[model samples]
Target: MRAVRPGSARDRPATPTVPGLLAARASADPSGVALTVHDIGSLTFEEWARRSDAAALGLIDRGLRPGDRVGLVFGENEWIDYAIAYCAAQKAGGVAVPLPAALPAGELRRLLAHSSAACLVHGEGRNPPHTGLWTATLAELRPGAGSLDDVRVRPGDAAQILYTSGTTGEPKGVVASHANLTFGCTADPRRRPLAHSRHFLHAFPIGTNAAQTMLVNALDARPGALTLPRFTAARFARLIEAYRVGTVFVVPSMAIELLNAGVREKYDLSSVLLLGSTAAALAPSVAMALTAAFPRATIVNYYTSTEAAPAQTTMVFDPARPDSVGRPASGGSLMISDGEGPVPPGTPGEVWLRSPAEPRGYDRDGDAPGKVFRDGWVRMGDIGHLDEDGYLYLLDRESDIVKSGAFKISTLRVEAALHEHPAVADVAVFGVPHPVMGSAVAAAVVRRSEVSTVELRAFLTGRLAGHELPTRWLVLPSLPKNTAGKVLKRELRTLLATPEGDDAAHSS
Candidate 1:
């Protein structure tokens, strides 16, 4: 409800435990504003540490023991409170599980049951019906009369359990250790891009992987972290000018919206020195547009997944190789393999990466044996290739690649080509059932203005091969997107299956 700006509080902690990190920050600069949720309120380092400490006491008071899982059900309004609960869980030697607030009731119930969560801590009015789990509000996690004892936590101890987005299948919980959660916490702030910014801006939802990364960036990278519970193109642009945001983190979808909204022309974004896009591949066209919008800023496209973090690719947009997602980061290794062994240079295959920060594996209840994890490497489930120089270039999700009669087409390549058209605002290329071809290329296009499918196909003639062009097309005002800004291709397939929208599909 209120915004408070505190003076410089410079305290850096070198602890590996989540609570130890907070304790160090609080001790260094207790009055520093650590987290800010737009239109809500903020928490100073001291306030965050104290409240979380009390919450830890409460967890202990409620019989939470080491390795116990505590599920968190909070939305944007409860970010600060969620942070407190997160630390409290770690301090009490418990594992914190952040549940997506937008999940359906059935899915939520399933996740809680699957996670074996001992206690559920939620925001005000955000609690769900429980058959057996203990439930409490963030405010209810109060300290008892007795002094709270510090629970010892090891670097190898499990600190958090993050569920996958389940785009391909059921969501599996990935267990991260304290060392994984605390990676880069002790890095020199003066050298990092975020350290120079007074305010860092991001709009990732609370329970997603990107949001967790932003939370760490808040504690280590920048002085204050600003967030938008809901994302809108205009609002995000204005926030930069309003707060003079120096560092920003976004996904490809948000970047596209900003370019299309033309908000950069309406706002003074000169304060922004660094803009980073992640969680999905950055379309080359969108990358170019970002560079134009923030001429004075360094635009970076980072490539990483929840299962393979710390080991990531960071690219500072070069015109020569705009599509490349950069090389393997320091102390990390990446390779492309075709199930048997490493593939030749420039061959597309599953992207496998090994990073010290990677989780040991998924929860025992989840599948991690030989499919996702094998030979000490995490299969990214992404289709990509490495250049002769070893830079990674992501094509598309292996699941979304279109398969025609005799050819496999990279949907991302087609989508990227479509984006180059002036009349096309957005596009998603996928596969659909065909009478003869078994599967044919189908595209869902969002145009800037009324345009005929015939005209669009003619435009892409030179850019894509004849077979790569869409045989079926649907022109919609916008593509269906999830909370994380990823297009829901499954829904698109379902939409095409219905005859009601059949008339909208145009053939080349």
Candidate 2:
């Protein structure tokens, strides 16, 4: 068996965490602008440093200490406040736990209970209605305070406990190290780490791992980076033109919203360059749509997760192969293997990655540290395979795979096929209970026009392989999605709530 991956680990350097990099960038560009919000005044690195210092000092004055976990519960654009909380936590030796703003109150209560966070810092009006707890806004933390000088912090120390939607349908927190965060943040150039990036835009509040990864990009180019507090597709288009924003991270859904909102042409987006797309796989059709809109930008699709942020893969780069999540980052490693061993070329298996990009571990699953975090491999429970030239192709999450009559079907493949149908607007595929085959393939879809099960099945007939088509169809106004926009198969499967025949005869 191949042990630790060659590149992601070999490349990790002394002081290979994020806080150190923040310190270095601040020193080199102290007088430079470091942060901003749309129409709001920007801050210089010196100012960011001072604000972060004051924020940290205020937290300390409130009795925060190193090693304590503080919840960073804020909206996407105002993550700078979270960053201040994060940096302050680092200065005082504490971990910042960033939680998504969308979790229902019930879920938030459970997660906060699990995280054991002592306090939280959010922008005004962004705090969760935690019912029983007292929350403080950044504005309320201190009226005016001076910045503190650099406070030493060590690498390999726990930095953030980033929560993710867990496999069992629970929200699990993944612990990321300063080493992992810093090393991965600086891995890309078009998306490099700078004290000042030309311009930045975030459509939501900073909570999920998606925003965390983007924050790394903004902080690297500090003082110059600015964000919108909420997603106003029209307003965002104007801000990009007004600020000459160059880099943006958006989900496919948000891209759809922007196009639907009719904002791209109203503003000059020519200045924007790096347009990164993730959180979910992009449809080739959607990619083409995006490509046409941002003719000057490369719409990059990458393989990533909450457990392992991003890495190289067991795939061959072939842009013509529209189904793939692009080539691996410059220095990353991956292997596709059936449960027992490595797979041969073209065969599918659970995709495993080994890199410094892997989150150190999760809050509850010590197994993630012991089994997944080997000398460095992270076993992301995603099913996929590699092509001949070394590129990764994701099939689906293991839990999302549909097994019927001895055949395993990837719902993502089915969704991709359905995406091409003219009337289909959105679709989600999952397994429904079946008395005959243990499970049956099912799909829930949103459509532009009323579509019958027969018409949809007829459409799928020519587009999909025999065993790869859905066994049942349900037309929904819209598929259910989590705050992050991931299709909630569990929710759909519940709505499906009954068995269906696994007979291939029913397939289109």
List clash counts for every candidate, in order.
1, 25
lDDT of 1 at 339: 81
The digit string of per-residue lDDT tens for model 2 on 1-508 reads: 3333212232345545565666666777777665676655566656666676667777767776666777767666555666676676676667888777666788777777788887766667774666454567776666234333434456657778887765346666777777777765442235554323366666645667777776665556432666777776787787778877777768766776665555666777877666767777777776776666776776777667777765543222235888887556747778787766689868988887766453456675455324455556677778888889767788888888888889888888898888777677777788888899888788887776666768888888998887777877777776776666667777776666644423212333
User: What is the TM-score of candidate 2?
Assistant: 0.85
The positional error of residue 293 in candidate 1, measured at the CA in angstroms, is 0.6
**Residues forming the 10-long window of minimal summed lDDT in candidate 2:** 1-10
Best by lDDT: 1
lDDT, candidates in the order shown: 0.82, 0.68
In model 1, pairs of residues that clash are: 1-40
Model 1 poorest ten-residue lDDT run? 1-10
Q: What's each prediction's TM-score? A: 0.94, 0.85
Compose the digit string of candidate 1's lDDT tens values, residues 174-236. 787777777667644455446668889999887788988887776665468898778899999
lDDT for residue 233 in candidate 1, whole number 0-100:
91
What does candidate 1 score on TM? 0.94
